[model samples]
Target: MPPPPPTHADPPVLVIRPDSARTLGLAGDLWAFRDLLWSLADRDLRLRYRQTALGVAWVLLQPVLGALIFTFVFGVVAGLPSDGVPYFLFTFASLAGWALFAGILTRASGSLVQNSPLIAKVWFPRAVLPASTLPAALIDFLIALLLLGGMMAWAEVAPGIAILTVPLWVLALAMLALGLGLIGSALMVSYRDVQHILPVGVQLLLYASPVAYSASNVPERFLALYYLNPLAPLLEGLRASLLGTPMPPTNTIVWGATVALGTFVLGAAVFRRLERRFADVI
Candidate 1:
């Protein structure tokens, strides 16, 4: 045993340290862990529909059901105007945009807490957990979009040339959701109240925005304050693009873009500030 004492010193250890110079190097860190991001997203996507009978069909079904309800409650009963477009088409178009925001916001907001086991056990960019939620939500949005296409054809309503700008509206909505999600997920680690509060907030927001009606229905006195909501104009813009309604004013578009992007940056900052404590607290 004495003679068997190791002749070589202990093996070298690899030291890991964070870059303090920039704690929130989101872009670089995300790129570095891109594979892990996709892995988490794929796992979620599979688990989401694993036991479901309808599977992805639910994506189409959900919005159809929601559109039907909105069409009935607001269009039929409330007698809300949908500008020149049929109320169902108008509501469906806006729901498409709303679903994108709602899906991403809800999923990403709960991501950190939902993945607490992995988060506690592993060391990776925490942002990836929230970011991973986006892919699955985006896939759902795309699936629902096919249904929208067929509905559009059936209605014989052609989107105008402004339809080319759909991507811009989508981007704005996504940015806003991601920003809000980042903040919500971070807060959720410290306070469970956020999860409870968020759904109520989203419900209130749904009614506040032009989900079942046109922006034109908003009284002129409330126009300025309404557009300040950011979602109002973007959703309106998206609906207009797809249903050939009038586009939101240029000023509102600029304001919404600014708010969306600014919120994203702010959320990233807040997440980074709180990230160091996530494993300890959650």
Candidate 2:
């Protein structure tokens, strides 16, 4: 018998074409490969701690060290307000949450370039590269939260009904980080400048955000502009709810949430729109 012709019934067809289509359909595309999210996240986590002595202990130590520095500079020396909680407790709690966002953003921003070999060889959603960073970052967030809980207990800060909504505020921050990450990751594929600027930008954002300080620190004249950062109201509300301080006005919180949602949608669209060129550029 002569050579048999190769045949595959309903073979998967991935048509790589230049995209002008700006659609929110990236969700469906990414959802199809959800398993890869976990796999990639696990692989990344293992690689991160591969040869490290402390391994996961770094998670607890990282925020603790940062908090100690902030406690001395902002809490002890500067005598910043902690909304009635111990300044160490206040700064540490906020730093825990802020770390989640910053960590995710940093991972996601460089995901494409770091995984360029896989991007070129494998057929998968590029978005997975960034989305996978979330799990590892979230794991760190949970560990850090345990530290925060201990701090809260030490301070005798009993949370109220507002604490129940902490997840909502977290989701809001995650959405914003993902949105920013997608934009940065996509841009980095073609423009290397984004990679260079991202670190400085994130550092500036940390100060702009209410991580080490309270929202009330901003002068009245700048309150409106400050809340425009979206994280301002969310962080303030979170700190208040967790530490039993007063939450920001309900209107500001609602507006911040709305902005968060919009950012997510915008980021997704931008990522998908530019996703087609990733293989060529990366």
Best by TM-score: 1
How far is 25's C-alpha from truth in model 1 (Å)? Answer: 1.3
What TM-score number comes out for model 1? 0.92
Candidate 2, residues 1-282: lDDT per residue as tens digits? 986654322135535445534232577556767788889999998998879999878888999999999999988888888778888878887887788888888889999999899988886778989999999988888887888888788778888888888898889989988998999899888888888899998899899989888987889999888888888888887777677777887889999899888988999889987887788778
**Global lDDT of model 1:** 0.88
Model 1 residue 92 CA deviation in Å = 0.5
Model 1: worst 10 consecutive residues (lDDT sum) = 5-14
Q: What TM-score number comes out for model 2?
A: 0.91
> What TM-score fits each model?
0.92, 0.91
CA displacement after TM-score superposition, residue 49 of candidate 1 (Å): 1.0
Mind giving the per-residue lDDT tens digits that candidate 1 earns over 105-160?
98999999999998889888899999999898788777777788888899898888
How many clashes in candidate 1? 0
